[model samples]
Target: MTTYAVQRSLPGITMEQLAAAQAAAIEASKEASEQGSPVTYIRSNFYPADQRCTCLFEADSKESVEKVNRAASIPFDRVEEVLDIPPMQH
Candidate 1:
């Protein structure tokens, strides 16, 4: 699986909405996994002022990520593969 970034353009999004979306994403991912299309929703960074969010997911392909978002009833602007670089401790 590879990490991907799913960008969502949500206008006037609130904390409650974000929480609900996250939960839905998790359930949708589980369902997708059971169907053989594994998708793991990692975490998200939300910008309340901009009404947008960037969510992370691990899946076989970007399409898989998008499928999960759609199944979760979440609207996303784009889905692209991303690289995760860990910080080095000094």
Candidate 2:
């Protein structure tokens, strides 16, 4: 599976909205996986000041990632494959 980053520009978004979006994404991913296009929702990072959010997912292709977002009714600007580097252990 390849990791992907879904970028969105959401102006005037609230915490409640963010939470709802995450929940929707999870549900949509699960549905997609059950339907055979396996996808996992990793996490999301929101920059309130910039009104931007990036969501991470592991899937077979960029189209899988985009399908999940579209199923969840989440609007995204771009979807790109990414390398996920873990933090260094002390």
Best by TM-score: 2
Give TM per candidate. Answer: 0.93, 0.96
Taken over the whole model, the C-alpha lDDT of each candidate is 0.92, 0.97
TM-score of candidate 2 on Cα atoms, chains taken together: 0.96
lDDT per residue (tens digit) for residues 1-90 in model 2: 999999999999889999999999999999999999999999999998899999999999999999999999999999999999999999
Give lDDT tens digits, candidate 1, residues 1-90: 899999989998778888999999999999999999999989999987788899999999988998999989999999999997789899
Error of 1 at 51 (Å): 1.1
- Cα deviation of 68, candidate 2, in Å: 0.6
Q: Could you tell me which 10 consecutive residues in candidate 2 have the lowest summed lDDT?
A: 9-18
The predictions' CA RMSDs to the true structure, in order, are: 1.1, 1.0
Error of 1 at 55 (Å): 0.2
